[model samples]
Target: MIVGRRWGDAVDSWVKKMQSLVGYRTFTVLTIVITGLLLFLLLINGVRPEKYDIQEFHLSTETIRSIKTVEDPVKTEEERQRAASEVSSVYQFSEEIGENRAAIVTSVIDYVLEEKAESVESLAPMEEQVSDLKENLNVLETDGEGIRFTDGALVSLLLLENESLINLRDSLTASIRDIMSKPIRSEQVANTKNEIERRIRGNLEIPESVLPTAVLIGRYSINENETLNEELTQARIEQARASIEPTRILQGQVIVQEGQIIDREVYRQLKLLGMLTNQSSMKPILGLILFISLCMWLLHMQMTKWRASKEERQRTLLVVMLILIMSVIGMKLISLVSNNFDVSIAFLFPTALAPMLVRSLINERFAVLMAFLTAAIAGIVFQEGYSVVLQMEIALYLLFGGLAGLYVIQGAEKRSHLLQTSLSVAVVNFVFMAFYLLMTQSDYGVSELLFYGIAAITSGLLSGALTIGMLPFFESAFGLISTMKLIELSNPNHPLLKKILTETPGTYHHSVMVANLADAACESIGADGLLARVGCYYHDIGKTKRPGFFIENQMSHANPHDSLPPETSRDIILSHGSDGAKLLQKHKMPKEIIDIAEQHHGTSLLKYFYYKAKEEGQSVNEEDYRYAGPKPQKKETAIISIADSVEAAVRSMKHPTAEKIQEIVHSIIKDRLHDGQFDECDLTLKELKTVERVLCETLNGIFHSRIEYPQ
Candidate 1:
């Protein structure tokens, strides 16, 4: 035993040393990091494991599935490129060049014919004149290569009788101008040259030599007037690419069928779906770590940055992490089952269970944080090897379901209210799923819709059912006094409450009055009003143990304390505080309530009994006449202490009024403050003033005077 005790002591000492060394914030960070690492490890497997562990040629040992459906980036890119390529390239037309070339050719031909050269002797001068005309036109210079005339074409032009060359020139220039006026792309130059040649030969009765020259000139003059418009072509290609939607595989879609040969195409698909037979990659592991880290950071921010009390920060963080870990474990188990069975009903997991529990036992801000974190984790864990759309839908389901449960349970009272919340959450979930299906335009058979509907509804129902069943355990294990538990304990039907009402009715009424005062005062001071009220209800439960011994329950004016020894009476009164604490502990009440019961009357001297003993010629130790207490440690308990005293004092007044109540309350508060009763609690002077004002107002209302009616 000694060895075991020493070991336990050493372990506790080590824990204390570590806590002191690391400090609260550092300890919180380390805890969150450890939780994130564990969650990352749990979910890294769920994030479609690195390539299936199969050999290239080996028979498939197990059926491989994609965890989440994702877009085939390579295939989508290829398809987009092909679509872009199929778009015709844009071209810019230069009509100015075509018109200038037409003018040059026509002018050259006209100049040659107008010379009227007699024969071959004059042909040289005529050719010189044509060349001069070409130079004057300046169109050929733009082309950089001057047009060449066919053999005998110049002599044929000079020898042409009548207006033959002129007519041919006009015909060729018109055709060339018409063709070049529009966009003549690079690929169309040859066909256009041929068409011009044919038009010159057919439309004009020109000599064959002249026709060849006309064709050559037309082809040369045409040039590539229409150049490719790079900017416009690129814009069109981008537009076409934008029109093509990304091709993605749906979640749970088979990448490679069972027993199918893993050919190149299948292998590519497997690799894209993260099912290829390759070594584990750090990319996914890093991604999971980052995502879990982000969740932990959000949790930390909510805890440290929110309005949580300084003393409860560590405990709140611990509880939230514990709840989140449990939730993630539950989700991971469901994912494993879904993966193994290839079922789509993993959505039926009670994702809302944790959020509702957190909202109930902790704060709503933490619950909201848990809702978002749970959704983000679910998105990663429940990814289908199909498209991202399914993953988003799962996230939506978790978020809406958790939020619905959280909101529906707010202000809930009776046990049946929880069941009503379940139904309400089911309706909300149904609407969410229906909206998703409608927006996505997903085609579903009756059976498929029924399956999803059942899952959605079941998710909400299971969340409610699990939260209802698990709440008490968390409350009991963590010593958490949730509003629901407080309400239940406050019920008159409870055994302890019933015993108080039946055996000590006057004390019960006095407790109720104290509850009213404390509730109002606590609320006014920005403290927990419900907690104060509930604590006040149970603060005097021990008086029921010996009902008649207390003055409040003794209906007959004959005082039981008058007959007993002052020391005995003092012991009986002090024992009530301890007795009330023991009774509360026996009933498994929350510690806050027990503390209020035991500490409302701090370690103050029982002056009435002390003075009675002193007057009776008996020596009384002041320490023995005081109630043993640890003092009120929280704002709510401290407020209850002051409010209880004020209520009993005001009730005993002969003529109660607002001014009288105010003076008495201030005096009582001042006495408590001076006696160091409020020293242990963190309540501020400002809060105390607010409590005094609220109590004064409440007392005024309860004891307000009424006008007499006419007789």
Candidate 2:
């Protein structure tokens, strides 16, 4: 049957190879084609030239309008021509009259009084005469051409003058009064006064002469009206020209016929569209390179600190990638939903979820690192309209989420415990949100608060659930031994412990006593009592293989030590530690527990057997009788070693009491200290004292008056 089977297997192998040749070739060709297509697509989209276009627009030169430049001086002929043009368009000045007539009369009176006297005191005696003069002047009137005095005194005085003098005085007074009454009719008043004066001059025999040229003032010129469209076009042209060049130019330089086809309109449009030619393209490229390098460096640093197995590293990498992708997707969805639907939907992607899951499943340090990384990534991906609140929410959630996982799961057990942890995280998240809202005085309604609460709770719970669900896979794949697993193994009824109890009852009882002592000492020193207790349970497991050969497992009928030589007995006792470690490894026990079993003795001397051999006159090296050990590597392991020795020593004491037990425990600790058992661990003198006190108290309780009672 074996020969026939071998022959048939060889034939089948040849037939299968021939059949797979075509399939293998097809698979190889398909893989190459897919790879080539993917490369082509990457090349097309990843490397393409940018385009630039120019557009035409009108331009106005502001420099031409405001720039001061040297020019040839104007000649006398040019000045004469300009003056003639100005004189052609000039208008005679008009004086406003009516209301100011009293002011002019007052001014004339003041001028006559000032010319006659310097001060009011010199003119005081002529007050009555001045009053009479004022009354006569007030009665004067201009009837179209000449003055008419209603006062008889002025008329008689004027008639008594040489008839010509009378006429001249009347004409002058009439012209002055008319001009004062109608100052706006300056041309009419001047012409009438001149004709009257000319007539008077002829009658008086004075020479006729043209009046000196009158001082003429011209009115202001009016500007032409411009349409709105023309003004707007001019403004646009000026703006375009102003934007095209720098404002200031160097001295001694002149701009002659500046180029106007630079297409400022196209440049402005490109700037608005973020496609300007002046911008550095390398900026984004540098940023991308820096960001990717930083991310890779951070990833490498995190993996190094984690020191995880290859499988564990891969799994963590996958989970982190998934988280990053999911976070990006969630941010995109939030933007879409909030923009198109409602803003309340954005509350769903709470930053707390990522850190919570990471901390619960991974270590605390890694969780915190991931939290920071996630927050930074979320800030970049989830930014909406430059809102700092969103970034703050991400940072706060990551911080509290990591803290929640670290605090709640420090020594946690069941999956349900993570739910409790989630509740704690939710409370923290809600408080943070509420505080933020209150501080900013936001107009968030009760519904918004409710949404935040629901989001926080749901996120925390989901994170915890995911963490718990992933723990088993991570543990198995990475060969991780958690604190919870250690606690379970420490149970009295564990299969290994049960086997020790059934096969070697004495060793089992000794281990239990050691566990009690070690737990008390470790707890007092702030060490891990659970690790110490669990280590004690399996510390003497090797005694089970050869039960009768060891003193702890030897029954009353057997006296193997009496029959065996001192060297042989010491060998048997020392070999048990190494044997126990091997058995644990065979059964796939954790390395930590195996370490405790191997290092409990730590090469300590077997004094009794060594002395016994010396007394028997047998030459034996003391090193040959010592137990082989790698020594305790931690405080808990060192404490357990001492406790193991202390427990067995105190058990052999006669009539032990609280005081006696205290003395014995202290002695054992002191001896272990002197032996340098704590050299490898971080235990200090203060912690050692606390351990001694706890041991004394626990030992006193165990050996109390009640325990000494007989039935």
Candidate 3:
């Protein structure tokens, strides 16, 4: 943003060369388009745009905030995993497995009791009976998951009483039925065997030694009755996954803090949000382009009212672009500061500066347009995040402030008037802020109110100060003839005016009288009276080169024209127009004043010397003695041309009565009309007659006859 002086000059020169090559309107359109592009870039950068790149588990070096609300997919997925883990795997309770296990246990118990009855009925030896029982216990491997027992445990079971055997069977059958009623996965088989063993030991009224035989019968009969249903377990998992809600990442949320490690979860979220991709969305760019195009279109329509010359149009457009670019940048800077600090200080933005400057340097319509422009841009720069329609609160307040400045800055033609206008703008700003706060239902204490009031006052005073400071620079740079510059040029103490007064007294007096007549005549014709008066003061500045050579400045009665050739005298008379133009240019006077000085005589012939050459029998051409002129191109210069000659010719009249003054004024206009001098300027016939009548009246007043007192 800080451009070097040499670089600035190079760019200025390049722009001027381009303007000359392309012409005014084409170059101005290009400038406006370029300005719109710049605004788009500035606004898009401010509109909640953030991106970052970070590897998983790496420490983040910067803090990042989200500009939109979206689901954190990574966290949501983690929650689903947890919910699924918390859900128990579903299993089926198989009634067929329970019935088979119960039948197996009853069959084993019947075999044990049959073994004891056979041993007692046969009166068999204890060893033979135990051996027979061990053989009998191995019924088949097909009963359940096939049962087995040790030889010692088979002997104890063969010795058990029948009553104890019946009790053991009942307890074992009931415990197995109750346990198999609930679902269980494959991992619970060993624990189920232990539960059956404990129940058999508690229910049997048998010897402790025979308890192992009874427990073995019960424990070995139980098998895996609850098998996992694959389809039903999968359904449960899916239900848990669906139950987890996605985690929402809200707008303005800080996704990462400095020095925080980007773990796998955070990394996934960043990827989902497009932060790590470094690829910005095309929506913001496309939207900004369309919006900016519309803004430039409005500007093109508004610029139709800028009434000026081609060069002035180019100059004013350049100034307008500068003011706009600077104003937007100022607003952007304020937005950045306020947003960063989280302060509610938007009222401090100096939104009125552009409108005041535009109104002062150009027309009020352009100022009004600029006010809307700044306000709309404020809407963009001050928005908290990306939105279809930006916040209108700040935009509306800015609009009122800018319009207030434009409305009151018209009275600020003088520096003293600027303070009064500033006061009015400040009051408007305060009232608007007050209305805005009340409308939005903002709660505030006295200190907060004071902050708002001070900021409002600052916005207004700053606008006025900046306008006054920059006006002179703009006028000088653009070669604009602003009213303040015109007033400064009209001062009697100006160096050019003093030079005319001191060096050529008679010409000075003549110029002043001519200025009065021209001023009065210009007023009557609806021309610039001030411009004509100022032009008359310096119209004859070239006479200072050789003051005595002209009749007005001649001290002695002896005519210098008597000795000099008529051609030489004619050359001296004709040289003042060009010389004055050159001198005024040297002093860097405005183009309008310089044009008046050069174009006033408008190629009218010096008849005195032309006829004198013919009388002396010297060969001469009539066109050769005429003043070199582009002619009067404006109304003020044409009126000054008539008044200049009118004052000079009538001053030579003897007994200058009102009748004679009117006759001479009429004669001067008739001569110029016949000579085609007023042909170029768009002065209507009625306006010329009015000029004629007003000049006569003014001359009559200056040269009125007075009654001499008898002494």
Candidate 4:
């Protein structure tokens, strides 16, 4: 017998060890997968792509000139060459004519000066006549000769016609003789005047003859020696250098040579190239994909933590994915609409509906994170500047909508709760939108305001609709028990609750008191009061199977303990918790609530029966009478355990008052603390104290002053 017991104990121990090891291994794998997903997302989103290069072209004076003269065709190559040769021939001839004219003018000036210096009196008339002639010569005509007198003249007739002519001629001759007799004062002036006269011989014709010649020369055409392609290439090369090149071939012109500053140009070119490369969509695509993946991983972890059941996990994920898809599609539709209408609809790209729906269906923390990620991705995809504002608005809407849902839908029961939540979300969104518009000083008219209001309402309604539509799928997939379902199960008319009430009235009463105590305690500790209350309602359901065995249903009847042995009685009492768990499972109760019912006793000793047996001199083990239980692992379950014990203990009091109830509550809580009943739960010492106070108040209220029923 000892060997058999030892072998059984060893096997039990090995099984527990293996279970722990498997759990640990599963957790480790999950952690690794989540971490790898996060890392991959970071690598994809966090890193930016290299930019493209652009070539920078500079404009120069030569380029401007080329552009300006591009329309003209007069400066061709052949015309430029011919014009150059003609210009050379004309220049040589002009030089020769200038030299000869200068010499003649110099000799004529010297003769006049000699005549005047030698015979000043005799040459007075001639000097006067010469001055008059010089004055009239200003308007004279010429034909490739010296100035001609307009009036006809004959020298022979002038010598014979009159004595005055002979006198004038002889006097002029004498003056000429006198001038010839005079000594020269300055040879330089004579040489200069002679050089000027020779050069001006034919070319220095009077204005009347030279004006027409000037006009003809102005019309002369010149030939250019370069083709358009050659000119363009030359211009480009010169532009590459910092030189000035002729855009057109002109006579007596040369192209200027200047060195190139490669460094400055190269830097500008590289900068442009870099800009072009940076603008590529590939980098943004990679970054967006990475960001989205990270968001998914974060959401996955958050959902995993929030959901205690597989169905809940699946539901939250589906809802989140649906929200994201809807947001993307809505943005795309808005983009298309805006483009088609030629309006600014980019503001609607980051759909506020996505995060709003997520918050309504899942939770706020995940919604906020998803909102930011969506905004960032929208900005990247749309390539619009207003994506930032859209993102901010989306985040704000998420916050408001999530708070509304959490506030109105907490411990929800009916579908009407969803409607209420939607209304709350709409109100919050409208108020926030109004505040935003006021802050931005927007010039919105009544129509615009109405439009915004409609949009906000639509978004809220959509969120609620999506939540309702998706809730069933999530519930099935994750096997989650929502507050709504819990409330429904807690109804007094529920099949199981009715069975307990009908079969074991005493246990039903005890369950009611337990529910009240648990609700008060859980609420005080900021735990799920509704879950605790409902859990307490069904905690003693197994007593219905054998109603007569429990004391609750033994009203005014003989005690069954008289017939049953202490061990049998203890087993019957202990078996109820296990039986209740089984019943809960059969009824498809959530594991969380089932755990509360199962763990309420938590292996506590059945001291009453055990000590009773001991006093009778019976050999008995205490473990034999102890309740079979798994210890409470959560705040709700721990709260339910304490409430169960305290409610039963307080009910046993002969006379209960406010002060008595307070004392009893404090004592129960203190004992539980000393016994380490709350060690596994997340409840803090302060919360425990709060729970005790609330329980005391609730008990005092329940046992409040009332007139005794008339006998």
Tens digits of lDDT, candidate 1, 1-711: 345434434543654565688987687878788888788777876664545765555566556666566788888999899999899988887889788888878776766655554334565565665555444435445436676664366557666765777777777788878888877777887887777767766864666656666676777777678888899999999999999999887666666667866666666777776665564567766777777778887887787686544445766676788888898898888877786653377678876888988998888889988999888888877776544522777888889988988888886875557777888788888898789779978678888888878888898888888888878666665557688888888889988888889999999999999999999988886788899999989999989888988878888768888789998888889899999999987766776788899999987778889999999999778888878987778888888888888988998899898889989999999998998888888888998888888899999999898888999
Stretches of candidate 1 exceeding 4 Å from the true structure = 1-27, 53-261, 265-274, 305-312, 339-343, 387-390, 433-453, 493-495, 498-506, 541-576, 603-628, 674-676, 679-686, 706-711
lDDT for position 213 in model 2: 8
Between prediction 1 and prediction 4, the one with superior lDDT is 1
Candidate 3 has an lDDT of 0.79
lDDT of 4: 0.57
TM-score of each: 0.72, 0.55, 0.62, 0.55
Which scores higher on TM-score, 2 or 3? 3
The candidate, 1 or 2, that scores higher on lDDT is: 1
Model 3, runs deviating above 4 Å: 1-16, 46-291, 294-307, 386-393, 520-528, 555-558, 654-711
How much lDDT does candidate 1 score?
A: 0.78
What is the lDDT of every predicted structure here? 0.78, 0.58, 0.79, 0.57
Evaluated at residue 101, the lDDT of candidate 2 is 36
**Alpha-carbon RMSD of each model:** 7.2, 17.3, 14.8, 18.6
Write down the TM-score for model 1: 0.72
Q: Rank by lDDT, highest first.
A: 3, 1, 2, 4
Model 4 scores worst on lDDT over the 10 consecutive residues at 63-72
Off by over 4 Å in 2: 1-373, 381-402, 419-458, 473-479, 707-711
